[model samples]
Target: MSTLSTSLFYGGLGILVVGLLLPGWDTATLPRRAVKRRIYWGATLVALPVLFAAGWPDVQSSLAFTAMACVLMGGWAYFRTPNIKVGGRIITADPSHREPDPTPRGGGRP
Candidate 1:
């Protein structure tokens, strides 16, 4: 494999494993959201080069790229997708949620 391909493959794999282990790690506490974000970005960063390689016009490069991409994307899609929690009840709404209306009944507010 080319240097880029090897780097992407190994880097992605390393990030994936670290992300998996982060929850159980006792060194420091990482919030669920933060953990998810780290894993997402890490996996994405690792896969970018692989994706680029897979899309290359050259056959050998494409094969290597595809392999790396598959590994990274597969792991990312499987593990990372479900961990992302959005719009949960704990997420506070904007201040506008409690604010009174500023506009007049029919015309623009002064």
Candidate 2:
């Protein structure tokens, strides 16, 4: 029971941390950044006390769970980051419905 709750708390924490550190999150405008800043800080303020209150009775499991969560979430998020190659040319090929004729129409078998 305790392990489950601790694991859930840790998992949520892991997701939040990975989302914070992941690139492209800060690509917002000033107003949008301000709103997100507020929300991020606001969630931290609200969550810490609640988590402390819940985990204070079982410190060991909470810490261990949080550690495992960090490792798992961090690795997952790392691999999921955009793999754009700088200065690389991107070619999008359109699939042809019909194959091209083997020989040209007028110039064939002349």
Candidate 3:
């Protein structure tokens, strides 16, 4: 249990780092960047506390409260962030849809 929790904690930590670093990335456009930011940050918010709880059982109760707080806050922010367009696709709360085809129209398979 400890080993698994430790691994998860590190994984969540990596996600948090990626979330923190995304704003510095320059290539993504505004909409794509915003969507990515929300995703990584939201995941970090929800994952970190759970991992921490597992890794530190002595503080599990406190971490559980922290996790609930994170869930409420993260969920609110996740839904509140406005949808954005990346190329032709509108990225909404559900981003699982297929990405916009990157090829310029009338340019892909001729």
| Number of the top-ranking candidate, with lDDT as the measure | 3
Better of 2 and 3 by TM-score: 3
Top of the candidates by TM-score = 3
Candidate 1: count of backbone clashes, pairs at least 3 residues apart or interchain: 0
Model 1, runs deviating above 4 Å: 24-82, 89-110
- Write model 3 residue lDDT over 19-66, tens digit each, in one string: 545552223333444456566666666666655665576676447645
Give the Cα-based TM-score of candidate 2 against the true structure.
Answer: 0.34
Per-residue error (Å), model 3, residue 31:
2.9
lDDT of 2 by residue, 1-110 (tens): 47756665765675457445533223223233233434444444444544454455678755655455455544443344222112432121323312222222333331
Candidate 2 achieves a global lDDT of: 0.43
TM-score of each: 0.36, 0.34, 0.37
Instruction: Tell how far residue 8 is off in model 3, in angstroms.
Output: 1.7
Kindly provide the TM-score of model 3 when superposed on the true structure, using C-alpha atoms.
Answer: 0.37
lDDT of 1 by residue, 1-110 (tens): 66765665566556555655554211134444444545665665665565555345566765665576566655654444443334532222333222332233334331
lDDT agreement with native, every candidate: 0.49, 0.43, 0.53
